[model samples]
Target: MTEQDPQIVYVVDDDAAMRDSIAELVDSVGMRAETYPSAQAFLDVCKPRHPCCLVLDVRMPGMSGLTLLERLQTQGAPIPVILLTSHGDVPMAVDSMKGGAFDFVQKPYREQALLDCIQAALSLDRDRQNQRETGHRLDQCVSTLTSRERDVFDQMLAGSTSKEIARALDISPRTAEVHRRNVLRKFKVHSTKALIALFAPAPAATQRAS
Candidate 1:
């Protein structure tokens, strides 16, 4: 899907009334909704690129909701899941959470409560997708660096001054400074701190270097 496409709320419930009601609730908030009569219907069209989450019913005719969640876990990127079940199904809901369900709601839930949960799930999915995209971009940027440039980049991340880097790399201080500038330009960061922030969750050694 295009980057500008609306995030989808996928509703999977064998009960037609429940599916339509959930679809209506999702649509009220301006998000797109795709309803399925069973878990298999959802599995058939769940694409990796879709920014969506599952509003799954705990009990269904053939493949149950938990089964669907387990199957999806092995397929590709994990989709946020919110289980809908009756009050008596509380134990199953707890079990579903351990299996990676985002949240669960009891039957007779307020429309607003369900809507809020769905919105939260959609936001979580969006953030996850954004992080993946950012990581891909970072890899692409790293790929453009030459071996010498890469070495200089690592040294800079290690917090070496130009003079020190020159000694370490057997290059002149002037050359080290040039490489530093190139590294900054390539990373699109104005300063070392900004670079470090962009490369957050850096190694302990890298943090010490910074």
Candidate 2:
């Protein structure tokens, strides 16, 4: 990626040497790398706008990597995090995954393995960004609907037929059909099935819940 539109890889470790080394590795792969000596230092800076992921040391001086991960989650930040841990810390790292970390790598990690993990984290962040953008667009479309049309929209989503909607709304079937058509037009979908698909919860979210 070019400098103007580069993906960012943030490296946060209390150890200066390790932090610098991880930054260098990320930079070598053509992504923009920003280094911080502590988790708080990383949080002090403004959040990155471009697609990004975090490479965090599991043990830090002030704010531990797990604490930072929890803070990010509480704030609803979408950036994926890959924790760096020692061999003995594997159990904690696995727990971190359950806590929303993208992944973790053991210290003395293979260079290629860490790089691969970072790439996957970046991909996940991109998917999250896209989902948010699409949701915003759908919300805008919904906002454009008239009150009666919105009622029709909800009914359509609930799998209501024109006759059923007419009875519920105390309107004629022909009038209900007209509102339904208007709702479809506003959503830019040819069919109710397509509109339902657009508003459906993402597959990843469903999987996580299951």
Candidate 3:
């Protein structure tokens, strides 16, 4: 995939030697790693259009690690972060986790431990990407349905029969079937069973429940 594609690892740390060493390690493991000297430099240069994990230092000059994490939250960036800190900075590391950091490590940690954590973070980012893709595609399919088709969809998929849907919409059973077919086509479902199965999850129910 291209560099901007959503699967590369992005490293951000203010220490030049540390960044270079980590980048070398990443390269040795056959993964691409681009390092930045500071959080602002990373922000300025990174488009971050991918499944990425930030290897960040907990202490920095301007916008420290926690501050950067908060900024990322405000921007809705889904990039997973693995915070690195001094040995005595355990509290800061714990606070980072409370704030949704992917993982944290005390400085002078084992190389294998850091590498393993990066692998885990990358896996999670991939799952997030898939979830985003599925949700977006589902939304596009829903957009193809008209108002009445949507009503038929919501009611029928909620376990209402054709006659019940007709009564609810003040229409005949045959008219309800027409709307139901349109809804099925919009959702690309082969049958009513499949249509109902789409909204089987609890969150889906909460969003469009009867």
Q: What is the C-alpha RMSD of each candidate to the true structure, in Å?
A: 5.9, 3.3, 5.6
Candidate 3 per-residue C-alpha lDDT over 94-181 given as tens digits, one digit per residue, 9 for 90 to 100: 7777676878876786788888888778777766776677678778988888888888988977889889999999999999999988
Error at 205, model 3, angstroms: 19
Best by TM-score: 1
Deviation in angstroms for 98 in model 1?
Answer: 2.2
TM-scores of the candidates are 0.89, 0.87, 0.84
Clashing residue pairs found in predicted model 2: none
Ranking by lDDT: 2, 1, 3
Q: Score each candidate by Cα lDDT.
A: 0.81, 0.86, 0.78
- Candidate 1's C-alpha runs over 4 A off are 1-4, 202-210
TM-score-wise, the better of 2 and 3 is 2
Candidate 2 per-residue lDDT, tens place, 149-177, comes to 99999999998999999999999999999
Tally clashing residue pairs in candidate 1: 0
Model 2 residue runs over 4 Å out of place are 1-5, 205-210
Q: Kindly list the per-residue Cα lDDT of model 1 for residues 90-185, writing each as its tens digit.
A: 888887787778888888778988888877787777767777777888888789888888988888777788898899999999998898888889
RMSD of 2: 3.3
